[model samples]
Target: MANLDLTLKDMMAVDGAVGAAVVDYDSGMALGHLGGSKALDLQVAAAGNTEVVRAKIRTMEQLRIKEDIEDILISLSTQYHVIRPVSGRKGKGLFLYLALDRGRANLALARHRLRDIEENIEV
Candidate 1:
């Protein structure tokens, strides 16, 4: 199984990846991070995205939606931000956040790769 550091490295290998982090949504803290440039502070982004995840979860509960979230995508003029909640039993309240250059990323493939990587994580 992949460890946290390896998982973070794998995420950085994705095309156009600008930054990545594993975060705890419950605490708005990053468990690990990589590849943040001057324009992006991954730790700060991770903490901010926790609110997005929490808000979505709350809305889903209010709407009584039984389905789990796959991933939340935010499209920006220059970037694509993907937040994927870990599905492993031990990984509840954790998520993998990825930032990609909009011109170079393939959204579908990145999602697929992230899911595969998440599955391999030992937690």
Candidate 2:
């Protein structure tokens, strides 16, 4: 299984990847991050997405949906934010956050790649 840094690095290899991070939704903090610009701070992006994860979880609980979240997609005018919660027992309370250029990314492929990366990630 891959470690946090290696997983983040592999995520960047995806087409149109701008940044990637392994974050703790509980603390809204990044465990590791890679490939970010001055205009886009990976840490800040990671922390912000923590709220997105929490909000969705809360909503699901309130609605009594007995389902797990596969991923959350936030599409912006110029970018796509993909938040994937870790499902492994060792990875509990953590997630992988990815940012991509909307114009350059193939959303379907990116999601597939991210899922594969997550499966191999070691907490």
TM-score of candidate 1 on Cα atoms, chains taken together: 0.97
Give the residue spans of candidate 2 off by over 4 A.
none
lDDT of each: 0.93, 0.93
TM-score against native, each model: 0.97, 0.97
Could you give candidate 1's per-residue lDDT for residues 15-123 as a string of tens digits? 9999999999989999999999889999899999999999999999999999989999999999999999998887787999999999999989999999998888765
Deviation of model 1 at 81, angstroms: 0.2
lDDT of 2 by residue, 5-71 (tens): 7898899999999999999999999999999999889899988899899999999999999998999
